[model samples]
Target: MHEISVAAALMRRVLAEKEARKLERISQIVLQIGPMSGIMPDALQFAYDSLREGTQLEGTELVIHSAELTTCCRHCLHLFDSRLMHTRCPRCGSEELQIMGGDEFFIQYLVTEKV
Candidate 1:
């Protein structure tokens, strides 16, 4: 699955960070995922857990934060949560919308121990 590749990339970044900073251990990785990011948290977690074995990242915690899908209605200038794409605005009944959030996937922060 693509999650495996994603996890691998994440691990590579973490390892690089550890090496660069001379960290003794990494305690946690905080990831922010949007509803439309097309990445499953469970699969990513499983892939990360599997790939971290026998590595410096072993026993590291993966914390996932899910972002809500939000949009702004052009007609009414009202901002609201949009659970689905192409959703009509509740206040103005307009299909014209500007996506404000929920299409992001990134590492928010990492907790590490210094040697």
Candidate 2:
């Protein structure tokens, strides 16, 4: 699954920082996930839980900060919130639109220990 790769990539970064800080263990990992990120937090958490065992972050918690999905209308020059991929604009009921935010899946921050 792609979640495996995603976890691996994030772990690599966490591990490097842990090493630099002389951390004996990791505490938690915080992620900022937008609504339209298309990545399942539950699936990612499960994957991370399985893959993290026996590693420096074996007991570390994976916390996700959920983000909302929003879009902007190009025709009416209006902004609105959306949970769907592409729907008519809420302001002017126009189909023409553009994405302003969301669609993000990134690591925001991490908490670790310094041994």
Candidate 3:
């Protein structure tokens, strides 16, 4: 699954940073996932749990937070949350909109124990 690959990449990144900083171990990983990022949180957690065996992040907790989808109204320049199937602007009722958020997938922070 793609989530396994994503988890592998994330682990690689965290391990590299841990080695560079001489960290002892990772305690937690905080992730920010956009609703439209196409990355499933449960799949990601499963993949990470499967891949972290015997690694520095073996028992690390994975915390995921979802970001809301946002859109900018082209006609009124108003930025607002855009729900699925409701793309119209709430302020101006315009259908013309440019997506501003909800396409992000990234590691926000890592809590680590000192070496």
Candidate 4:
């Protein structure tokens, strides 16, 4: 699955950071995932669990946080949550909309043991 590649990339970054800091082990990794990021948290965790074997992150915990979807109406200047999956403005019913968030996937922080 695509989550495997994503997990691999994430581990690469974490490993780089761990090396730079000379950390002995990672305890936790916090990730913020947007609703539209197209990543399943379960799959990500599974991928991480599989990939972390025998590595610095072997016993690391993967924590995921959800980011809300927001959109701005280009016609009415209204901003609102898009959890309803509506493509238009809820206030003015305008079809012109600009998505502001909910397509993000990034690592927020990590907890590690210093060497």
The candidate that achieves the highest TM-score relative to the unseen native structure:
1
Candidate 3 minimal-lDDT segment of 10 residues? 80-89
How many residue pairs clash per model?
Answer: 0, 0, 0, 0
Q: How many backbone clashes does candidate 3 have?
A: 0
Candidate 2 TM-score, C-alpha based:
0.83
* 4-115 per-residue lDDT for model 2 (tens digits): 8888888898888787877776788999888777788888998899999988788899998888777888898887776677678877989988877687888888876666
lDDT tens digits, residue span 1-115, model 4: 6999999999999999988988887899999999889998889999999999998788899999988888899998998886557777879999998888788899999987766
- List TM-score per model, in order: 0.86, 0.83, 0.80, 0.81
Cα error of candidate 1 at position 34, Å: 1.8
**Model 3, span 16-91: residue lDDT tens:** 8888988887899899998789898899999999899988688888889988887888999998775464668889
Cα error, candidate 2, residue 50 (Å): 1.0
TM-score of 1: 0.86
Each model's lDDT comes to 0.88, 0.83, 0.87, 0.88
Position 88, candidate 2: lDDT: 84
**Prediction RMSDs, each to the true structure:** 1.9, 2.0, 2.2, 2.1
The per-residue C-alpha lDDT of model 4 at residue 90 equals 79
CA displacement after TM-score superposition, residue 33 of candidate 2 (Å): 1.9
Enumerate residue pairs that collide in model 1: none
